[model samples]
Target: MRSPNPRILYTALCLTGLSLATSVIAQDSNEEVSRIEQVIVSASREPETGLNLTLPWSRIDDDALKLTGAVHINQVMQRAPGAWISRGNGQESLVALRSPVLTGSGGCGAFYTAWDGISLRAPGFCNVNQLFDVNSEQAGAIEVIRGPGTAVYGANAVHGVINTLTADPRQGPEHGYAVEAGPNDYYRVRGEFRAEHGAHAVGVHFNGVSDGGYKDNAGFDQQKLTLRHDFSGEQWQVTNALEATNLNQETSGFIRGFEAYKDPNLKKVNPNPEAYRDSFALRAYSRWSRETGAGQLSITPYFRRTSMEFLQHFLPWQATEKNGQESLGLRLALSDSIESFSWSTGVDIDATRGWLREVQDDDFSPNQPAGVHYDYEVDALSAALYGQANWQLTSRLGLAAGLRLEQNSYDYDNQTDDGSACAPEASACRFFRPADREDDFSNGSINLGVTYALSDDHRIYLRGAQGFRPPQAAELYRLQSGQEVADLDSETITSVDLGLRGAMGGFSYDASVYSMQKSDVIFQDADRQNVSGAKTRHVGIEFSVYWTGESGWYAGIDGNIARHRYDSDANLLGSRLDIEGNDIDTAPRHFGSARLGRDTALKSGRSLTTELGWVHMGSYYLEPDNQHEYEGHELLNLRLALALGKGFSTTVRVSNLLDEDYAERADFGFGAYRYFVGQPRGVFLEFAYSPE
Candidate 1:
């Protein structure tokens, strides 16, 4: 791998130090002092102030969500350090958190995604583009943990965790609505209603969107609905939530050639107009909690159903695949505190039934058949037991530790004739069907940390943790090149982090450095065989800082400098290559965003807010050989909002303000370069109304 870039690291460290120094100087000034403490729930599955948490995490609040008005989740996710949601054609994305943008059937298993503290999908049945199945567009808050979360979250928390919290009926206006319009014939409508009676409250939120897309024949229509009910009693509190989402999109395949995104005409062309994806998901859950003599007891049960159909345009055979899953799960927890010690313990249980089918219409070659490639069904069961505790040994020193044990089992049934799909005279087929079989995996994870308080508003912490993910169903059953069975071990990662976080005199900052090592990584070898026992290493420095002046001005910056490299010799593209120490493809060394804004109050109870944002993506190799590269790009964004008294407001946003040309993603595959052209400059306007 390439040597670490000192310039980039130095710049990020300087910014973080400046924010801390300014806080000290401002604290001594005569100006009014203000402090804010943000609350997060992803750390321990309970509301806790971020200032006191031992984890490295970030949150995007409702105010920021409203001001940004993101059509894509990537817009708001960029504000968090060490995070990158790689955007694809309309509503599709690949996630990278403290690691490279991993791709493949099992890549999505590295990160755990949830809604309202409930897992969105059952273990061993994850989809790479599953983020679109949630209603993040209208979430009350989005929280992200940058490193391993397995100790508290169980399996599939190898890289990190992201949780989207639903809007609470008691916190916002009673009735609200918004209408938005933008370039490319795009339109969206959003509405919400809340009602309270006695000790019961209900909230209904919904949104719909229609877009004419930037690339030819590439458009999408989507809808999302959420329902929340809450009941407060003397001894018990109950919260119920239901969420549903649907998406129908015409996808555009990658355009090939070097720097094709720079060509105006080529950038707008679609290579596969017939490529499309349709997906739907529904989830419901209820959480009940109360104070008890033993401890604070809580119980939660959830149900989920999801289905999807998409054309595999990236493959030469152009096969179509359909898949779905239905699951039921439950979570129970208890917590208590005595003296200077606090502790929590929990148990999780889940069961799911899933099925998949793939078919090709016409023959592409002798090795690629035209009939059904594979058809199979799987039943999965997962369970875990976990506990965590904290001890305040002294007024200034503390210690924390957690441990988890999880088991996952899968029962696979094949509905097709076993063996290769090609005829006997043909060479080994590219697709193979495995016989019916059963597989099971068990894994353990643990975390330990220590913290020391420097003063009333400052503290430092050091943490070490382990995480793991069982192989997905597809990776085991969807064999290739005559492989009869896949015997793969669970993937695991160990990470260590050192950090500091605090808030003082209207200034808040978080800075951390982390190193991680992964083992038993699953990937296809150069000879097209399923394999394991690979290894990789990751190291990075991440920071986020913000300053809000009493005069209604604020500035903030967040970013990371990191390197991801292979720790073992490997082969690539049918060639024997010594790839040890080489930088992983699509893994950028540095990327980040910065923002400057101010707010002013006008006469008649009106207000005005303006902000500008800068986003940077550093260069990285497009292939393992490190022979091809994509030079990075930067763009600017602007937003202005006007609040007209009496529950009326208007917002105008401009994306890609400088009209620069760039590619949202770049790749080298099939012996050619491919790019997903970024959208051109766009202007969006929205009008909203809410009654007081």
Candidate 2:
């Protein structure tokens, strides 16, 4: 119903033209310009360079991450285009990568999150609060693939993928330690060590944090450890990575009522004092590679174990739930070049066993007898076969295609009685257990693309892809009180993308436009029953630009204008609701960020950098009825960094520089509106030291 401001787009285009003109006039006809060096590994299974990957992708290197002194993933992901991360509290978040702030049990499964090369969780079981399991805070680099990923990845890559890469010692070794202090009695200590000897290398990273929360009865302390080892010979190599994390969090619940974020007193109140979350996770993976006659062979095996428990504060009935899983997986691949084509083929297999237990300890109103709500165990097996080929049809044209077939099976055993409601306290049972059953899903995906190089510094491409995801175990097993069983099918989304990206002189830019349609969408009805067979549509334009000046000044912008709406009408819990053409709840139509900064080198062997950033989120509906809307707000941030002699540096970060009072997340459910209060202006100071 609304469109972005035309003046903004005009201004950006004018700026791009001016930058191109400057590049042409500054160089002589005989002068040669070196192309920018770009390296990416997640777009494909192997290392590649430049923008010829035929997809929209981005990377945040270690240097940019260090300047922010960030403590959360949200802080570091700000520069990524067409992406958003909504922080619920200290370390909890909901991710939207070219989609809405997907909520509920199946929300987290939309985005495939991984560390190194393996996913953090199994396919059937994904925790909405899973990002805490990753060490992104200390990662050397973070790679993001927007829209549907390639066929090399399976299952939960419906929306996108985020891979955290471990630091390498061969890139030059340097050890560092840092300490930071901030408002609300926040304190953190971090350490890193790296060394290389001949063909062997090792790296270790550790961080611990303690925070006295701003809200009453809300605080947390957590720690993470990461270790990596790499050994290489003339024709073979072995690499191993290990990560462990422990967390103790006093989670916060939504503060009820409309415009609650504007109330100063309400922002400092914790409605659910009994809410807490505890979790421990361990992950390790190893890879072996060798050069063969046909091509290069690589095999990887990974293992993961995780346990977590938290109070369900969002529901009317207060319950405590615990869940854990252990899994083992293997991936083998081979890649080789023939003539003008490069091909890669791979197979992936994994097995997992997990359980869930929950009980109602308190009832908000009309108390029912305390009883078990859900108790079950699931054993799942998954396997996939995938292949991709890239061909250079001509000097200026390239073609790429990929395909994957996957199978997922679940064996569920109910530990509780199959019933319509919790027995003794039927009044308080918001969940029911189904009879033990076995379910299986077979899914496939195909992608095709073609790219043409317009010049030495410009390229254009078009892509079409189909992505799918099997039903999550929680969606099938965790049912509402009145529902006897959940009959749901796999969800799929088809997307078509067209765009241009390139680098000229000191400027780099990427622009894309795309449309998508999704089928068999699983969602909660008016009565809170989980069901499937709904449809939705997505369409958007994404743009990102950066310019580096010879005078040490830089400017960049990452923004998107998009629309997501219901595509069809369906029967919802005996109610004839016509939701066709309705805007998706919590999906903003206009959002983006801009940063202006400068870097300078001082005479005293020191370097200084300062940045001013702005973030914007447009208004959106809070209910499917479109009766309630949230007027989104904009915020400002500032950061200053100073690099001293002897590998020592200091950073000062100021969040909410304008002190805009807003909600980090908002929703209307069960006849009430809720919000997670946003933070006020706060300042943090960090100091680091490393030996040369």
Candidate 3:
């Protein structure tokens, strides 16, 4: 049952009006209307040999995504199969695709996450779960690229890319907002405006949300502001943006799971396992292009700076945490195909700086020890050069190839001195001399692929590529623990991909199958050694379909299943893994999602749309002993929406429609029992208004 909040109740009432307005204006008389008159998607790379390929790259139009009733950009990305989101009991989240990054730790910080080419990755040890200005509000569309773009995107592009394209400037007045309040006293309100004056345009978005924890120590509150401006003249265009978010949230009490199940109402040491962080970002992009008799040539340059603070244990051992990362990149592309070849080359560079500190507390154990302290700074720099070429072997055959070379270095200095366990105001503390280390590392790889046209409407592609991720910070630090050693070299992979794409009978299908092997697997072995072993291997395949034409019906299916095993002593697992065929912890062997929906005209001038979706996750092992398993689970969700003319719209969303309880991942405490809790069923009504 939803808590009755006046603010949320008012929002529902407003939504009802949008539903009525859309219905009154939803006559087929304007069925010919189109939201976009022109589409330009080549921003990712220069035209490939198969410029005509119709691949099913998953995309969510802002209008449709808003109906999901999700406030986070990462949350909306869940619509894509194979993509995984490991959310914390409260606000933090860890994400990765097929090749999972060891959750938490700065090294596993999502294999990669970026915005307009700027890496959203933070420099904190918790980098793996950065949640700053990367909000989902005011986005025009989100493009989820399924596989690795190493050849094209470089280092951070190890797994996948979720690019959030901001909205374009509107030519007229616009005012739209939606408010939502639900069962947990969770409420959010967002609105924005955009306008264009000749060659100049400006837009802004503001949003805020609050929710009381369903359990002890679990409430959350957040606010965000985003702004953008664009200007163009002749053959050049320029754009700038700033996004900031201030989030203060407490530990929405854990599900109270311990080794020895205790009292139904047990009070933990940290009454509030609370954490709060502020994220700020500034970025700019400028591009210049001109038509050439040979083809089209364009040059783009980008710069960004982000700062974030994570109060490690804001509610308990709380101490201030600070992190900042900056990046600058420039690229030039000349698009032109001779009688048989087309080529493009780009160069990018990024540098990162980080800092960490342990704030001491005396509450629980104020007893004996240094009060608080902070560490020096650690910095890293990475640079890369890449080139891509495509050859038209003939009118029906094409070849594409690319190679990227990269180098990075790391330095840490100025350690904090241990206060003489007895000092006045902790002053006069000795400062450890700075110790710095630098290493030269480089990686080079190539991607070779081809497209064969079977006819005018069908094509087949066979792509095989090799790429790798360098040893991260954690792998190196683990050396001090006297456990697993080190992987002095780059962790690499070589995989084969087969794809088929075509457009026929108002239907389009783009499918692919991939089998990849991680050479010199860089995984923490059973002995906790970060050594090179034949174990870390990833093999998987995926299929996606999208269709929308004269039928007024839209349907999409996306799913993937991956099987992995390390070279171990286990005879039970076919891969000969050490655990005797026992799969890795937390890796779901089977996971998939499907969406079915239709678009139809309603009475009056409004339109009605309904959607059904299902998600399935296979069971996984929870403990190394393999005695217990986190059972598998399935979920069903539904949403219905009405679109009114202008920016007015309404939607009803039901999540966890089946009311099932299952853990997406396990976070066992020091206790013995397996602790887990799944999200309960939730429902919400949404409303919005936007006009051109």
Candidate 4:
């Protein structure tokens, strides 16, 4: 194993610091320094901290968590604009996003996303096993990088980024723990008690969850443990986090394709579906930084290993996968403006290896046995250099520009029998070919955006950016002939965005319109000349407005309208798919939500905050050709909170208030789309006590 060339990274850091000190000087702080619980980024991954607004951006501090009850990260995300979700028996079935890309399946592309400055999207489908599905209670402050991000972040940042800032030792630096229980046989208990003594802080957090799901046998359980430490001094600061998480749950199935909506009770009797999933993961990271008047330069090294086992009980299959990654990077930040310009740059590299194996299993019984299972492995390496700059040409006008160049290489090799053919039944026969393919490619993406002050409370902006995603091995190679696929290209998209923001009568609002034409899309070809090839166009509008005057007395509305079309004409029900008229598959034409809340003061500083929220999704046609369609959906959520003292508070929330039935997601067959009930109007309550 080879480590990163720190000698070079360190040299760059020194040069960057010298340039910063010579070019720009730190300006005096003037704006009110408000410590807000929520931070909403302005199109960039950089969050705007200390913001108090009702514009779909809600900050949940420890007190608010206790007052507006929600414990899980997923539940809190639903409160955000464009937050949509659904769950399967495996607890892995839940997938939520803001206008994610898709094929016959779901979540094809991502926007700006980062977990402590590292990308979270794994190679495989970023489904259940991949999501950092930890309980929200363990987090310190959940920072939401709102709206589409065109900034310099990791791969998964298409829609936006939600960075969960874990807890530190500062809140108490002593022993403390939390436990809670609720209806539906729901039970969860987490404890985080830390200790600090003179420049050193060390803490441990343990979380466990298990609940009898609203539907029969739909519950799940997971236990996560973490050890965190931080050291602060005049010359150096160090932080470390080591985590281990394991998931164990029974297979849960939902009616989809045509089974659901037909028989609402399909959730009973286990549904006899061949769905199951299990995974274990360990992640560790260490960061060290030295303070320079210019800024703090840090080095981060991380390692992660994840193991997954999936069994299709209803079917004749069994499989297991293992993934590992080693990454090292350096960050040099300069917060001061150099003669009126600000900039930041860094370089990073990631090396990953993943493998999948098919186990011999027969669903029919011991009388039936399959022979000679196959194993596949892939090696991928990526290196990228990125930089961002903000130049204030004048006090009223600003310019932002960024670019990233990435070089990626992939190699996939597997065994023969590469599958005795894609046949349902066959005797021992070596009818497959061999696979030894490798490809290396490079690409560059750029972003240019400008923000101008229209007056005092109004601003206008114009932005353009490009996004891309490389197809995984499975999508590139599907057994054929005697040899496996060895050639494919990356998918890319270019977008043009127009936006407007202003405030009126204590109301702040923002709206944006964007159009994108994507090319090099991977698709299944008839001749097998290329397993992936297609084109698409997406156009949409997004708007949000909110207020921030009195506690509880607030309201906000937000939503989007999109039109997705397929290029390179095809047939929809025997007719050439009409690009100009056909609706994109699963891209809901409309998605909107609104919320209103106010605190009813019973006495001085003693009040109850009650909130009502509603979300609507426009009807979407199941197929791209628009042959069939699923009706749109609407959901309502209600919450209440009470604060008794400056340091104590409690909150409760009920989601899916209407118990609406709809599909959190949809694909083709084996899809799992159903009128699955929401979290059963879930009720979550939390209590908090703090000393400042």
Total clashing pairs for each candidate: 1, 0, 31, 24
Candidate 3 structure lDDT: 0.57
In lDDT terms, how accurate is model 2?
0.83
Give residue 662's lDDT in candidate 3 (0 to 100). 58
Candidate 2 lDDT, tens digit per residue, 124-233?
Answer: 89988788998888888888888888989889888888888887756634688999999898999999888888999999999999988878888899999999999998
Q: How many clashes show up in model 3?
A: 31
TM-score of 4: 0.80
* Runs in model 2 lying further than 4 Å from the true structure: 1-37, 363-369, 424-429, 571-577
Angstrom error at residue 372, model 4: 5.6
Show the colliding residue pairs in model 2: none
lDDT of 1 by residue, 66-145 (tens): 99999899899989999999999999999999988988888999999999877788899899889999999889999999
Best by TM-score: 1
All candidates: TM-score: 0.96, 0.94, 0.80, 0.80
TM-score, predicted candidate 3 vs. hidden true structure: 0.80
**Cα lDDT of model 3 by residue, 1-692, tens digit:** 32244333323433443343334332332221221111324224532222233222455567556667674444566666567666655556667566542553333532556555456653222266554456566567665555555355655454556666667656334667788766567788988888778888888878888877555556678887777788776765567666666667664333435421123344222344555555555665666666667566666676666666666552234556565666565666666667687666666666666555444455333222235444545566767777777787888998778788878665655355422322444333321122344545587777788888887656788877766666665444323223322436665667677877654444445567777666554554433345554444566776555545344665555566676544354222112234734555566665656566777897767888888876666655554335555555666788888888766788788887977655545644334344334556778777767663
Worst 10 residues of 1 by lDDT: 27-36
lDDT of 3 at 366: 26
What lDDT is reached at residue 483 by model 2? 77
